[model samples]
Target: MTDTIEFASYIVERLKQTGVKQVFGVPGDYNLEFLDYIEKDPVLNWVGNANELNAAYAADGYARIKGGLAVLVTTFGVGELSALCGVAGSLSERLPVLHIVGAPSTRMQRSRALLHHTLNTPSSFTAFTDMSKQLSCSMALLNQVSPDTPNGYVDAFDETLRQCLTQCRPGYVELPMDAVRAVVSTRGLNVPLPDSHAAPSLEALRQLTPPGTPSPINKLYKDFGFFEPKPDEVTEHVVKIITRLYEGAQRPIVLVDACAARFGMGPIIRHLVEACGIRFFTTPMGKGILDEHHPLYGGCYAGRNSLQPVRDEVEASDFVLYVGSLKSDFNSGSFSVHIDDAHAVKLHSYTTQVGYAEFPTTDIRHVLPLLVGALEGVKSERPRVLGESLEQKMKQGRVATLVNRPEGTDIVHKWLWPRVGSWFHDNDIIVTETGTSSFGLLPVPLPSHASYNAQVLWGSIGWSVGATLGAALAAEEEPDKRRTVLFVGDGSLQLTVQEIGTMVRRGLHPYLFVLNNDGYEIERQIHGATAQYNNIQMYDHQLLLPFLAGKNPATPFESHVVRTQDELHALLLDDKFNVPDRIRLIEVVMPRGDAPEPLLLQARLTAEANSGH
Candidate 1:
């Protein structure tokens, strides 16, 4: 009896090891049994999202912020399917999340019964599992008939989590409703999960592919590659090559991207910039990793779609040390980056690319430190790459945009984001939606230690609203009270706006900055400038707070709409508004035609690409 526990308790215990403080989900019939365990757990809080999709996104945001495992629970078939798109985003962005799906009972599944959630066919039992398999690096659909290990569910659970960690992406597990109550050995729980598992996940995954087809794993490795250390000599050789190139170039700069943070290598990268005294810039994905006020800091780089000063300086540089770059179209300004393979040295978690040559096994963790040490003493002729510092230029631009504007004038994107930038406190979590909110925030720099959480690569609308909830919850777990903030457009917010209710119920305090430009401003910039498709029905946003926050809550919420410059300026300066206590919503009114410079540039580039020009 001492050696066993309830199946649901076992899973919760596994989660406790990952240091995840909360589990996000929408309770359905299949998952109701599991929810009982989640609700009762003292360590892990159950954050009931408005829907399955938002829960998945919340899980993603939580993992990204917490830098640990994120667990998302859902019911069978329909519930899990609804959450897949959000899970897919996490998978694509290499966020570690375990999608625990409470599935049908073993008896029901094996009997080939027409389940309520099924497609009315016996063969449809495996359909959802099959569909989900494509989205996850590894998955285990456990049942009574499933092959059992010595420890059964415990071993399977550990193995599944191990895959999620090693792959640094999403993984899936299925727990039958009856299996949630199954007795399992306590032996597996006592033994901590290993650094790597003995079981071969790729070999098992290969079986799911077509019989004669080549392994998809190989193709995946070709694309995303793998992260591992190599022989001492290979790493030394790569470091020497980078050091040589750095010494030779008149103007050398570092271009950082999202994977540095994803792989937890930001500290070493930051150390490299400081120790080597190299000027550095960040892609939208890479922002907030380094201190923006650092002397060697350059502006955010996004090919041609960057601030004019940033674009000019980056393009002029003879050498670029690209670290953890994920050059998707949106992140890379519609594939407009001019830095070629010959001029750039890329350091990835998996591999290092020097010129046109690539080393498959030299891990960035091993190589980055050595390169930093090698270049630490070297004297760079040009430490400061740009004529005018990006920070100073931002100040100048702020004056030009906001200084002379009338009190009653509408707040445009140019004036809005910079003002928002100046208002941010250190160590805040800033989440932006895929529309103008994301683009508008790019040109301005964030405060030191601020965490930027934009779904730029995935470009999922309404993502920020759900992500904000997760970020806020994750922040609550931090020793320091890190303020959470969200900037989502009026149109994008409508997609998953119900998440506000979840935020209210949880008593999470996030600053929700809704950019009210009428509709999809980014879409308007892309093609339909004045078309009806770009328009959206307006919401009385000031009432959004009271309606969403339920009656007579523990903490009060503040909501305001600012149509003019003075209104926004006054609200931002208010001490009550700055406190991270109550949830706040600010609907800042702006011009319908106005957009951030980066968005305008990318939209034009996207249109050209679509037109086959």
Candidate 2:
């Protein structure tokens, strides 16, 4: 006889099996039943957030650090719709997030009952699912509670989860209220969920090796050796063309981008760089994907906004190998990049383009290792002439020079970001918001093993607050327990500031840096320099912390406000504040017009483009 378990319990069990330790969302009437299963599950905890949107953002952040699916549970229409923006952001960034909606019962839907959360129309039952279809890779609606249809439900759930893993995108599942406690076979739990593609070489290895023979394939099989499956003939042919271009070039350089992190190709790309000894640079979105401390590490390259030496090296290259590259306007300094397509080899998550040839289904994760292996014997003749390393330039105290101004001078962009870089330690996870904070970090030198997080492509403003909460949780789970730091604008903070309470509630302590620049300074740079629309209501940030830390808070938190250069400098050096025993918030006040150098340049370029110049 097959064992059985509650359907909701099975869902929670599958989530735990996939390495989800916590579920983030708000409890609602529709989802309360499913929330009970989450709470009672010994292995999983329900992380209640201030709102549905913040919960979704937290899930996205968690997915980024955890390198797996992050699950969020919400009620039917109202709660799920509120969280849609965050879900769309995840979809845009290719992050895997499983959005589980506790839907109404099938009986109610069959009767065409006007649900409180629904649109109040008889035919509004599938409205939310129809809207979600655009943002999710796959979806499953489990409305059947009959015991005989358990296999169908299981198959639907399994396939949706599979699509989420394979595509690295969001998936949706709607579980009716009546089905939450319905009985389902527990036999599916006996088999582990398929995690990745089956090793393609397994069948070949068996065929090439006899039953008693000690062949290389047998040795590899015995040792559990794994090779990324070989590419198809067309892919191999494209790789050969790229090999010829790369080998024949005099000065070749590698450009790394955000897709490296998205597809978990960081280690492979790092190995390629170290083994080949080729000079490499990261785009703004791909900043922390590679070790910046390496000698061959050139500074960030962003079209004309890049440092003079970095731009010269990139534009002058005879051949450009762009691995996991994303050429967004912001990433490319408003489409200012000047490389010819004939001289560039672009590698993406699922495709590879070499000169005029394009090969579909040519995954970067598979081709990168083979490309590295091919270049093992070949050596590049290009000299490392990408100018002074960022580390070397920072040692001269470039930002410190600006710090010598009068004591009461407000902190400016020229001195702030680089100074913050000096405070970063190895193994720190820094998350920057999508305004001046993101652009300012382009020039800062990150230490070895330090990871940077940003929503560059999505350009979400208030994402950092909720993301910080999730990232801090992920960092705490790490072996070394790296520190989590956040840089967000005041305008951005106002959008999702409630997540700070969630951080405190969960006992997560991260250094939260609020850039109180008066208003939307990034927008001011682009269009409105002094428009009233750009301004936001200022909050006493230091006082807001006490309110976020509710009665009988689990952890002690501290907040401070800095108005001048002297105050900011002293706070950075304070031993008690530097040691992050509890949550700390530092609000730094700056001038209204101050913005990062790169932001100003890009804003001007964007304005010129918009005006048809």
* Candidate 2 segments exceeding 4 Å error: 144-147, 190-231, 379-388, 393-408
Which residue pairs in model 1 clash with each other?
none
For all predictions, the C-alpha RMSD in Å is: 4.5, 7.2
RMSD of 2: 7.2
TM-score between model 1 and native: 0.91
What's the C-alpha lDDT at position 293 in model 1?
71
For residues 345-366, write the lDDT of model 2, one tens digit per residue.
9987556788886655566666
- Model 2 worst lDDT run, 10 consecutive residues: 196-205
Q: Which ten residues in a row are the worst by lDDT in model 1?
A: 194-203
What lDDT does the true structure give each of the candidates? 0.81, 0.81
Provide the global lDDT of candidate 2 against the true structure: 0.81
Off by over 4 Å in 1: 144-148, 190-233, 377-388, 396-408
